[model samples]
Target: MNTPLPLNQIGQFDDEADVVILGYGIAGACAALEARGAGGDVLVVERASGGGGASALSSGIFYIGAGTEVQKAAGYDDTPDNMYRSMIASMGPDQAELIRPYCDGNVEHFRWLEAQGIPFERSYYPEKTVFLMTTHGLMWSGNEKVWPFRDAATPAPRGHQVAMEGDTSGAAAMFALLARCDEAGVRASFDSIAQSLIVDGEGRVCGVTVRQFGQERHYRARRGVIVATGGFGRNEQMLARYFPGLPDTAEPMGIPHTDGSGITMAVAAGGDVRGMDGLIATASIYPPPQLVKGIIVNRLGKRFVAEDAYHGRTASFIMEQPDQRAFLIVDSEIFAYPEIIGANHSLVDGYESIEAMESGLELPPGSLADTLAVYNQQAAQGRDPLFEKHTDWLKPLTDGPWAAFDISFNRSTYYYITLGGLRIGPDARVRRADGGVVAGLYAAGACTAHLSPDGKSYASGMSLGPGSFFGRVAGREAMRGSAAS
Candidate 1:
């Protein structure tokens, strides 16, 4: 509520701590560990039976830059300023203050994770794929190398993946963080859901109401309460309300319990929200990186975005097309059976001539042909003058047998995540819509909007990046809140 919860009306606290963290995802775990390390009595209330909320499902990569050991071992030169310049356009000016510190402190963050026993390999994946299926440690997880960003800043591979065998390194990372939490003696209540924020007469958060087991319990915090519950991806109502452009066909990614419950609780406590309309919707057309050589045209048969753009960025434009329909036209040389099963890149048809394929797909007679005429002409010369697709992927569609894949969201599928939540300062303190701080309340992870304001702005590991980084920030800051009883 905009108004504060009166202390006299509140019931007796069933438990107490110096700081209480809601949810035990990467951010929550980090917050608990950091607070405990500072000697604050910490309690982590988790909705699941175990830790690692959505972070457990991630590729377990951190969007790190500024000359990490992995980057050095990969023989790439990077600097914090270069990384900052690369991210400014995406993060926008308001969040620009965030990039500098994150870039400068990135190497230290890597060392921090290393201290947690989460190993990181020094190998580099120099391919243009999404997540490495192999154990390679570094890859391009964002738009640093693409147009717009590249013009602003020199590119470097910043995606530092945890040393795990496969793409699902999130489990490995969370397991390690959870162990660190245990070692630090952070009290974690599993299967406990945070129902609401407990505030004092002046609207300062001091505890939380939790539903654990079969009972409703109150856990008081002498210093502060931090909400680290992940995003609202599982919440249908919130999605429909905030992201009106997101089609229902787009599947929500994350745990089933990522239902905006914590966000709603914080909002009810008067926490302001940001990026409510920001979304990360992706129809992955990579993995078969050869397919990126193709061109994606909308319903009117015009190339929308650069073929070499991040798949999520490409998909954002695709979903905005007429009827959310688009086609990926690839020559036989580049065609591969789509690796991502959920993207549903079904074949529309193959054609010997561009005219026949255009007519068959019901496009305006000359639409597809005209689009390809320019694409093929530029591509043959190792150039994409229009979209600036990297020269490395520049290949003419001169192959006889050409095909089109119907990668339309109206017909196929897209993996989506909500990127909007409680608005917070750089310190992870919840700020009201009127710009006043929600006293003693801090939040991190998906529940609090930071980086990744939209699909075009998203990077692969950005979700966990903000989650883990700010989780510690929230922890460190919460320890400074008024320790009044």
Candidate 2:
């Protein structure tokens, strides 16, 4: 057996409890509340002063299958089989199953959210209409449904969006959940960093070592620890180790501190890791302000995707260009829409706005004549003659004073780094390399990989949906284990 590292001493310490939840983000907070519900003592640790992980930076959309009472009452018919098939198709081979549970229990989970006083908005779209009727039958044609995945799924007319105070909507809801935890008397500590896991002679984990407020300390989990510290989107070492070759610029997406501490710690405790090769990448054009301005060039210098592809990765299909540093070409049209430049849709919005605000850069201010002139020039020559736009549709900068932002394709501004974390089975229990359960450990949220057989997100609402669903399940299970002991 390998010798375990000695526990490093730190400042003041507290007695370990039945559960030690790492990371105070959405999943961590949600799980802590659920544990409290089950009468288990819980303490949460977070490195950031403020709570909420990438959850705070989301548009908060979710995917629900059709054919349920909601769809049936609206004359829609969606089936679980169809939804599963579509997810499998979109995610490709082995990557799709990780998300299967969300589809199976989507309706119940949504109802559970309502019970928690959370509200959802319906989003209606045309393709969703077509797919709903053909796949689920007579359902509302409201959602952008992947018909191949489910027999019936029309996006809810108002079920797609959630709003919080100011633009801090996600943060507000998350804080509300944190408030619920406080009412339940769940213990929480901020500015704490989990450095390693405590394992016994037989290799089962007992607790963790954390550093907080410039001090290191130990917290034991009489029941078990939940590693909800999130993924390593900003950790270059983990990124290079798993994804290999992802541009260093990908760092602009999520919190810089979420460097997959949970994932690494779990690996140290004998938990098996899976799906390190898979990544959920988002494409962006605008570099954070102050960095060199990037130029979006197709085979030729020009524009391709709609400046508003902020809607989805559909831009990946539209730009049909090779991955050669092809960024986004923008002009006055882009500037007119305030949402395009900030953290409104893609994750890039936050960092982009920070740079623009700090630098006081006017960003070429709006001028239609100058924008079209450049576009028209490129259109006439038909070769990205000046801007290198080769897709054929993006040419003719007959518009004027255009500008370019270089970005990668198949990427988006805001992305959920879902490729890390402990490998768990369908039951959400952490699994050992020998295929055994890791005693009482569990995981949920983006920190854990979704293992979608399809290469894509499969469905929307995945990040929040799974986090909420599995967090509840895992929390309850942990409590039950604690009580049994």
| lDDT score, candidate 1, position 260 | 87
On residues 1-485, what C-alpha lDDT tens digit does candidate 1 reach at each position? 22334566677989999999999989999899889988999999998898988888888888887888889999988988888888887778767656677778778887888889888898998888777767788999888878878888888988888878877898899999999998889998889988878878777888888888889888889999999888888877887788777666778887898888878888888899988888888878887889988889987889988988888898788878898889989988888877888788789999999998888788888999999999999888888888898888889888968899999976778988888899988788998999898888999988988676788878888877768888888999999887956
- lDDT score of model 2? 0.54
Model 1 C-alpha lDDT versus the unseen true structure: 0.85
lDDT at 349, model 2: 27
- Relative to the true structure, candidate 1 reaches a TM of 0.97
Candidate 2 — worst ten consecutive residues by lDDT sum?
Answer: 129-138
- Number of the predicted model whose TM-score against the real structure is largest: 1
The lDDT of each candidate is 0.85, 0.54
* lDDT tens digits, residue span 94-180, model 2: 534455665677667666665565544332332221112111212221112322222333323212334333323455557667778
Q: C-alpha displacement of 149 in model 1, angstroms? A: 1.3
lDDT over C-alpha atoms for residue 451 of model 1: 76
Q: How far is 429's C-alpha from truth in model 2 (Å)?
A: 1.5
